[model samples]
Target: IVLAPVSLAAEDPLPSWRDGPGKAAIVEFVARVTRQDSAGYVEPHERIATFDNDGTLWSEQPLYFQAYYALDRIRDMAADHPEWKEREPYRSALAGDVKGLAAQGKGPVVEMLVAAHANVTTEAFTRSVAHWLATARHPRTGRLFTEMVYQPMLELLEYLRANDFKVFIVSGGGIDFIRVFSHERYGVPPEQVVGTTGGARFELRDGIPVVVKTGDISLIDDKAGKPVGIWRHIGRRPIFAAGNSDGDLQMLQYTTVARNEDDTTPRLGLIVHHTDGEREFEYDRESAVGRLDRALDMAPEQGWLVVDMKRDWRRVFPVAGS
Candidate 1:
C-alpha cells in the first residue's frame, strides 16, 4: 500500500478563526512584519507577542478561576483556624458569600490570599494548584479550569510561535498560579508568563533549600502595571498583543500605538469581544468581570482589531476529544 503524503500548503494557520475582517487583519499584519522585503518587516527577536489570560484567552465569567482556587484553598484550610469562623472575610468566605467577602474590601481579600497562598514552599503551592486544576470543575461550565481556555486563542498562540513570534502571557492573575499550567495549556513556558506576584525568599525547610512565599506582594500586573511588567520582565515591546477588557487597555496601547512618527514598527492589537453568549459569553461595558469599556471605545482610534467572538470564531472551545 502506498502512503499518501500530506499537503502542508492546504493547512490553515488559524483554522478555528472564521474568514472575516478580524482574521484577515491578523493574517495581513503577521505577513507584513514577517516578510523581510516588506516595509513593515520587523526583526525576529522583536517579533514579541503578549496576551492577557482571563477573558482574552479563556472564560473568566462568573469569577476569575484563580479566585475560585484561592477561595477553595481558604475553605480547605478553614478547619485549622477556628477563629476564622468569627472573622469578617473568613466567615463570609467559609459560608461561600462572595458578595459579602467583596463588601469587606481589598484588605480582607489580600488577607485571604496571603493566608491561602503564602507561608508555604513554592513547590507545594504549585502542586496544590495542579491538583485543583486537575480535579476542580468550573461552577458553571463543569469543565476543568485549564479546559476553559479558548480554542481560537490557543490556535492564535501556536500560529504566532510558528511565525517566529515569541509569545508571552501578561496576565493580571497570580504569576505562580498561571505558571503552573501555562506551558501545558498554552505552549508558553513559565518564564514567558508575566502576572501579579507575591514576594518570596530562599529558606531552609527540613534541612532542604526551598523558596517560601511571603505575604508581601511584589507586583500587580494589570492596567498601567501591564506596561511596566512587560518592560521589567520581557524588556521588549510586544509587536502584537491580544486582550479582552479595560484591564488590558494599556497593554494594547503600548504594543501598537507609536511613540512618534519616527518609530513606525509594525504592530497589531487584538481585542476578543465576547459577543457570543450562546457559545461562551456576551459582555462589555457594564459587566464587572473582564469589563470591556475603555478599550472597546478606543479600538477604532488605536486601529486595534476587535474580534467579535460570535462572528469571528468558528469554534469557541476544543470539543470532548479535539
Candidate 2:
C-alpha cells in the first residue's frame, strides 16, 4: 500500500520541547494511550491527568506566587494594622525580606498567611486575588506571574486536551487563589482545581448567602496529602500525572505505580527538573521551596520520566508574541 508523506508540523505536538528522551517519552505515551487498537488505549473519560501547579506547571522559585500574594495583601492591609510592623513574620515581610521571613520557619509564615488571606468573605478574597494578579509582577523576570508558566508544559496540557484527556490542577497552592487564574492561564477550569484550603463557613449577610474564609487550616495538599486531595476531588485514579518536587511524590506514585488487582491500564509519571539557571532558576534538593530530593531519587526506580529543563526544553517560558 502506498503511504502519504507525513507533515512534520501536524505530527509534532510539542514544538517548544527539544528532540530528546523526555520529549520522546511524552509523545510515545500519548500515542499509545490514544491509539484505538493499542493495549494502552484509554477511554476518553478514563484519561484523567493531574498536574502539580507550583513547580510543575509554572515557576515557583523565590517563593510560591500565593506567598507573594499574601505578602502583597499584608502590605495592602498594613495601614489598618500598625501592630504588624512590630510582628515577627509581618515585619520581615513588610520589609520585603523574604529570606528573613522564611528563616522564621513554618509557624510564623503560617501566621502571616492567615492574617493576610483569612477573615474575609470568599467573594472579597477572590476579588483581592484577581486584583493582585492583574497588577503584580515577578520581582526578577518582571513578567506577570501567570506568564511565568513553563511553555513546554503549556504545550503538554494542550496536547493532552487535544487527545480527549480531562486535565486537572492538583496543587499545593490555595484553591481559591489558583481558581482565579487556572482557567484563563492553563485552560483548567475552577472545578478541576484541588489545592490547599482553609476552613470556610457559609453565612447569610444582607439576605444573601455567602462563604467566608476562616483561619482554620483545612487541607495541606502536599506530600502524601496530594493523593488524598486527588481522591477527594477527582474520585478517579488518573492515568497520567506530572509534578516537579518531592511534595508531588505521592501523587505520582498514586497515579503511575499503585494499582489494584482488577485494573491494568498504562500510566505515565513525569517530573520537571529545574536545571536551567540562566533561563529559569536552577534548584532542587536544597531549596526551601519546592525541594525535589526524594522525588529525584525515586524517579529512576519508579520509571518516571524526568525532564531536565536546560537540556530537554528549547524554550523555558513562551517567547513574546507567541
Candidate 3:
C-alpha cells in the first residue's frame, strides 16, 4: 500500500514540543481517541483529562507556591502574634528559613499552614489568595507566581479542550487557593479543581450565610488520596492524567491502568520530569518537594510517558514579552 505524505505544519498540535517519542505519543493518542474513523474514538463526555497543578502544570520550586504563600502569611501575621517569634516552626518560617521548618517535619509545617490559612470565611480566604498571587513574585525567576505557568502545558490544555476533552486540575495544593488562580491562569475552572481541602463551617454573619474555614484537617489530596479526590469530585475516571511526583502515582494509575475485567478504555499517563536545571529547576527522587522517585521508576513498567523538560520542551515558560 502507498503511504500519504504527512504535512508537519498541518499536523502540529503541540508546537512548543520538540520532535520526540514523548510528543509523538501525545499526538498519536489524541488522534486515535478523537478521530471519527479510529477504533479508539471516544465521545466528548468520556474525554476527561486531569492534571496536577504544581510542577506538572507550572513551576513548584523553590517550593510549592501555596507553601510560599503560607510562609508569607505567617510573616505578615507575626506582628499581631508575638508568640510566633518563640515558636519552633513559626520562628523558622518568619526568619525565611525553609530548611529549618522542614527539619521539624510535617507536623510543624501543617501547624504553620493551618495557623496562616484557617479561621477565615471562604470568600475572605479567596480574596487573600487572589491579592497574594497578584503581588507575589517567584524569588528565582522574579516572575509573578501566576506568570510562572508552563506555556507548553497551557497549549496542551487548549489542544485537549479543542478535541472535546474536559480538563481538570487534581492537585495536592489547597482547593480554595488553587481555585483562586486556576481559572484565570490555566483555563481550568474552579469547579474542575480538586485539591486538599481544609475543614469548613456554615455560619450566619450579620444575616449573611458564609462558609468559614476552620482549623481542621480534611483531605490531603496526594498519593493514594489523589484517586479518592478524583472519585469524590470528578465522578468520572479520567482518560488522561499528568503529574510530576510520586504524590501523583495513584492518580496516574487510577487514570491509565486497567482494573476490572469488564473495563476496556484507552488511557494515557504522563509524568513531567524536571530535567532542565538551567532554564528551570532540576529535581527528582532526592528533592524535598515534588519528589519524583517512585513515579519515575513505575512510568516505564506502566507504559506512562515521562517528559524530559530539557530535551522535550522547546521552551519552558512563555517568552518574556509574549
Clashes of each: 0, 0, 0
Error of 2 at 9 (Å): 8.0
Q: Give all TM-scores, in the order shown.
A: 0.93, 0.91, 0.92
Q: Write the per-residue lDDT of candidate 2 for residues 81-141, one digit (tens) a residue.
A: 9998898878988999887765664334544675566658988988988988888999999
For candidate 1, list the clashing residue pairs, or say none: none
Across 1-322, the per-residue lDDT of candidate 3 in tens digits comes to 9898988648667888999999889989998999899888889899999999989998988777777788888877888899889888788889988777655543346546765766689998888888988898888888888888888898899889989999999988878888998888888899999988788889999999999888786887888999999999989899999999998899999999887875667799999999999999999988877888988998999999999999999999987634
Against the unseen true structure, what C-alpha lDDT does each candidate score? 0.86, 0.87, 0.86
> What 10-residue stretch in candidate 2 is worst by lDDT?
102-111
User: Top TM-score: which candidate number?
Assistant: 1
Q: Which residue segments of model 2 deviate by more than 4 Å?
A: 1-9, 79-88, 103-111, 260-262
User: Model 1: how large is the Cα RMSD against the reference?
Assistant: 2.2
Q: Decide which is better by TM-score, 1 or 2.
A: 1
**In what order do the candidates fall by TM-score, top score first?**
1, 3, 2
